[model samples]
Target: MTEQPSAAAHAKTQADFAANLASVRERIARAELEAGRTPGSVRLLPVTKTVPSDRLRLAIAAGVEWLGENKVQEALQKSEELADLPHLKYSVIGHLQTNKAKYVARFAHEFQALDNLRQAQALQRRLEAEERTLDVFVQVNTSGEESKFGLDPDDTVAFVKQLPAFDRLQVKGLMTLAIFSTDQIAVRRCFQKLSALRDSVREINPDIKELSMGMSGDFELAIAEGATVVRVGQGIFGARALPDSHYWPGFAH
Candidate 1:
């Protein structure tokens, strides 16, 4: 097990994390205002993938209810470590393999990368056995990058239509990883593609309205493009040991 920080260090982490959390929320609120959207309209999902479980206690104390993780195993480990924290919810925002559906079904509150029929079926079966339901977002590769794991734009509508069959999976909406670039227009277009697809997606399934896009780097652009849920890790939790791209799997959001 990773050793806990000393008392002094722990206190510092708490104070620093609380401040960062507040700052990120303020940024989200500001972005909402600039976009002409109602304040608190967009939910800030604190991505907690590689963040230490100790620091997460501080985040929970600071009133963070939802924590997003990019890996099911990591989420499971932290969830086990912090099982005593009440009202703490976990969202698996990473690519979930079919074999790992059982773990996600066991505890995750949400799964944001449902892009395949097989994975959905596996999750549904496991969730049924667990007697639980999960909120899910379909991932779309709007950046058109070969490395990104999401439904192709042309195939997303049909894929979404197949989701209602899985009673345990509540299709929330669409999600995407816009290309990681300094080009503002390119990033915005990726978000736009997901937003536009949500319109057509909602036609078949009206519940599909939320869009999970953006990361620590370009969340402001994401908000302007109609992202309802933004996955921000480094922004609120501070930097990890690895590059941001390494943490994102292939999506690098």
Candidate 2:
């Protein structure tokens, strides 16, 4: 039989994790404050994509309540296993498939990447069928990448105008993925565009209040451009374990 960790070893492990979380929270505060924004304005969502449920429980014990997952299947499994933890908030941060809308909406507190009207409508229908309301963020392709999945600036406005049709789905402003480059100017431009798009949406509907942008690399720039919710993964969890060659999983790039 395998030997379990001794009580002292477990206590030491927990202490190390607690210290790490406190440091991460402090870093977030510093980053937000550097941009002339209050520390509380930025909410830290530990992106526990491939991490197992045991790690998730450890995180919750260390004071992480909000978590982001990129795949519906992964999130679904973790949700079932971690259902006993009432304080945890799991959000779908991936490119959601239309057919998986019902499962995604079943647990996601916020869906941060609605790219088209079709997807939005599908989500609405699913929510109505399930008799639930979902918070959604319309993603914009600010980087103008052909590989990305978001509305063009013009199309995003039109999508916002049609949001009233999806009464059960709450339109919670915009989410964007900036071009993956280190050029500060380029990053700022993309973020600025998303912020402007958000402004336009708010003009049309006063209730749209979230701007879910930024990741580990460019989150500070995103904050400067008005990202109220930042989805940071590696910055919090450190480098992820490299996957095997044959595993062509949904989010395994």
Candidate 3:
């Protein structure tokens, strides 16, 4: 079993989860206000990558409606385990393999890291067979990082133009993993790039509007740069047993 993030009792308590969730929401709301965005314009995606189903109950209890998972199999297992929970939707926010499209097609309500036609086509086929449409985002690698999984900023326009053929894959927005760094300038630059990329791509596909960027440490900066959705895990679920490299291969080794 993947252990809960911290050894401290406070980390495992319902009161702690509730408090943490409220704090995150307040921060998001504050950022939206500072950015001149309308109230609740920014959506907070509570990332439950390593959180167990038992602890997830606490999060759902505290009013988390959507969960972001990095791996399709892990997301599937949790979905099966939490089947009785009402109205909870899963968003697969990590790099997805073409072979795993069936799993995502059946389980996820949305997929946020789509960068290639092969993956998109695979997902479209599966979704068509499943008789469901999937909301997707074209991921952009704005930081110029080789380890990150996304289309290069220069390639995004051409890439998005091909998405129309995959009707079952509803291109709802854009997603990106900014350079994992404390340098505010570098991080914010990433959000700026994705925001710009979204504007350019919107000309080709008007529905591609949402920008999913930022994480636990830099979401405020992302919001300032026009992030419609932020992916946060440790900020709410304490911490995970594995390091980020486990999910983001070749990053921060």
Candidate 4:
């Protein structure tokens, strides 16, 4: 069994969360400026995957209106636990199986890791049944890593064209995970590839504009490459116990 944090420990954690949030915002602003973009051009998405519900409540209290979760079941539980926070919205940022579409349709305001048609069809049917619409981003494996869950960059444009048929699903933009590496050049190349892919797709579908890329370590490079949404977790919530390889297979240690 896990031990609960002491009251003083919990208080310290909340204070840490507030401080981390402010620091991340400042970093984002600096990154945007370095990239010659407006201060608020990129939105910081706090990822709450694996975080306990009580700690998440503290995050919501710290003015995090939109939460990103890597697992559907966890997000659902958190949503239920914090249902009173009407302003809070959840975005599913992890790879999703078609069978789990109903869970996302039931509550998620956005789905960021959409890669295949079967999952799209499933989500469309579920959203239709729920009488709702969901904003989705086509996930692309810009890093060309076989272990990553995203459509091939070359296939993304054709794939996106087919999404309009699913009236209940709105194609908001594209999302990608840069290569996890200590080498900044290798990491930036991944973001650059995604940005280039987005540019090409944009010409064909003018409405698809958002590029959800970046994470705690490489968001600055992503911002320089025009990332509109950065999914930050560790930078805000502190380090998670899991290693990067657990989340992204083949991630460099």
Q: Please report the candidate that would top lDDT against the real structure.
A: 3
Task: Show model 3 residue runs off by greater than 4 Å.
Answer: 1-10, 243-253
Rate residue 18 of model 4 by lDDT.
79
- What residue pairs are clashing in model 4? none
lDDT of each residue in 104-216, candidate 2, tens digit only: 76877878888877788788888888788988888899999999888898888887888898888788778889998868789889999998888888889988878888777
Q: Per model, how many backbone clashes are there?
A: 0, 0, 0, 0
Q: How accurate is candidate 3 locally (lDDT)?
A: 0.85
lDDT of 1 by residue, 1-253 (tens): 1111111112236677787777778778888988999988899898876666776788788778998988887788778888998688899988999999999999899999999999999999999999999999999999999998999999999998888799999998899999978788899999999999999989999988899998888888899999899987777766554534323354333
Winning candidate number (TM-score): 3
Superposition error at 176 for model 2 (Å): 0.6
Candidate 4 lDDT over 131-246, as tens digits, reads 99999999999888888999998899899888889999988889998887878789889888888888898887898899999888888888989999999887777766453332
Shift in Å, residue 81, candidate 3: 0.3
Candidate 2 runs further than 4 Å off: 1-13, 243-251
Measured against the true structure, the TM-scores of the candidates, in listed sequence, are 0.90, 0.88, 0.91, 0.90
Comparing 2 and 4 on TM-score, the stronger one: 4
Error of 1 at 191 (Å): 0.5
